[model samples]
Target: MSNIGSNPLIHFAAGATSATIACVSCQPMDLIKTRLQQSKQTKDAEKYSSVAQAARTIIQEDGITGLWRGSTSNVMRVVPGAGLYFLMLQMANRRYRARTGHAMTPLHALLTGSFARAATAVIANPAAVAKSRMESVGVWEYKNGRSAVIDVLKTSYTRGAMIQVLGDVIYSGISFAMVNTTSPFAQKKASPTSQFIVSAVAGAVGTAAAYPLDVVRTRVALSKAQGKDAGIVAVVREMLEEEGIAPLYRGVEFVALRRAITTAVTWSSYRAITAAVGRARR
Candidate 1:
């Protein structure tokens, strides 16, 4: 029960357009989340404390622009990835209905969203790598999005780099799947308010559960870029021993906040956009 338009082209355009706007609003939260994840300090110094503290630090150190670090690379995949995600999930729903002659159940939504997001994540992995690396406070020093991609590609063609890329993609895929599978309830509701609230809540739940993987992915990706590949197991093992599980969940609440805002805005905007386009087509 998705509200995305029947036309694939419209659906794609709606998703891309909506996501771009949402990204701008949500980027600051994302920046703090990334810093929290990439952070390596310990004890009291390790604390970001809250969103306000993290923002002030980033602004004081890197200026306001720092809050949007790596946004170019992020936008690169975000638009198309959003487009592909919605389109594929919708297609999956169609197939499910045709085959079973029933609406998408919660289980169906989970499975379809997971598979669809996994596909989008694989295709968008390079962008993910670039964003995470450039977002890390003092990691790779790519000039911009294009340079970031080229620089990563130089190393990413290697087996080690590819492994790191796959790990990041898988992490993103699962996290997003968990967030989006809750789309059914949101979409089922016709009101924009209900949709926003439900989607936002769904996003928060997913981010809380899957955020640790995001930290691991960022670390592994950066390590690989520096020609020091760290497998997921090693990354998790070392982080656990060195910092414990708490570190893994750092900045998670902020991520949940960002996810809620982004999901609410993106889906509401998407529904509005597609509806407008549909009306114009008449």
Candidate 2:
């Protein structure tokens, strides 16, 4: 409930801290989500069987770094996104309370948070896409089929980063809105032990909702790096033809679990930070 926007430094600091924490805590699940999202079943599905299996496989194959494949992009996207989100939440909460003449409730918090997240997603879509791509498929494919981030970026660049970013912004905004709208209701009805269930559900729903765009973004990013021209429509059609609609929601469970943990951590931390700041100010 602090005026985060009014104090730019504090807002930024809080945002940075929050983003860092959120990314670190959820990176493993994020890796799983990316893998699932990017999974393409050939004649035989040569992919991890489940989320747990995926984690173990990644560890066995690529070491811990594989699990943190997109940590850089995650930091880039999250720091700004989270900063904007927290700042907006404070601003929105204040406005909502002033207009309604009531204190912040869970519903208010949820709506405001969702709106802020959507806004940030719009701005940070390209980065988010880049991060997801970097995490899921790496930057390039070697002759044998594996690539690095830099190589991937160098290959992809047809539409330019700006264009991709714009597309991402739109996709992210819609996705965040969907996730936010349903989260509060899910949480409200959940049992105490299952409070985090809603967060997971929201994450999964959001991932699925945004996944087609995510696939397009990934193809665009990777194709650009590979010097190929694959439009969003073409990519969507290709994915559908090759993998069917189910592929779009492949990594949903991982996304949901990651989201649940991230949300719980974020809210808990934000509350703690706000309280500490309040005590200090007082």
Residue pair clashes in candidate 2: 139-152, 140-147, 142-146, 155-224, 155-225, 156-224, 156-225
CA displacement after TM-score superposition, residue 132 of candidate 2 (Å): 2.6
Per-residue lDDT of model 2, residues 1-282, tens digit only? 453235655665676676679788788887777666556522112556578777887898889877877777677667877787767766665677689996555455545555565567666655565665666543433332123334444554333244344443443344344444544554466443343444444445544555555545655554543445777676678778976787666665566556656765665455457657767876
Q: Which stretches of candidate 2 lie over 4 Å from their true place?
A: 1-8, 41-45, 103-115, 138-216, 224-227
After TM-score superposition, the amount by which residue 46's alpha carbon in candidate 1 deviates from its true location, in angstroms, is: 5.1
- Using TM-score as the measure, the top candidate is 1
lDDT of every predicted structure (CA atoms): 0.70, 0.58
Q: Can you tell me which runs of candidate 1 are displaced by over 4 Å?
A: 1-5, 41-50, 157-189, 224-227
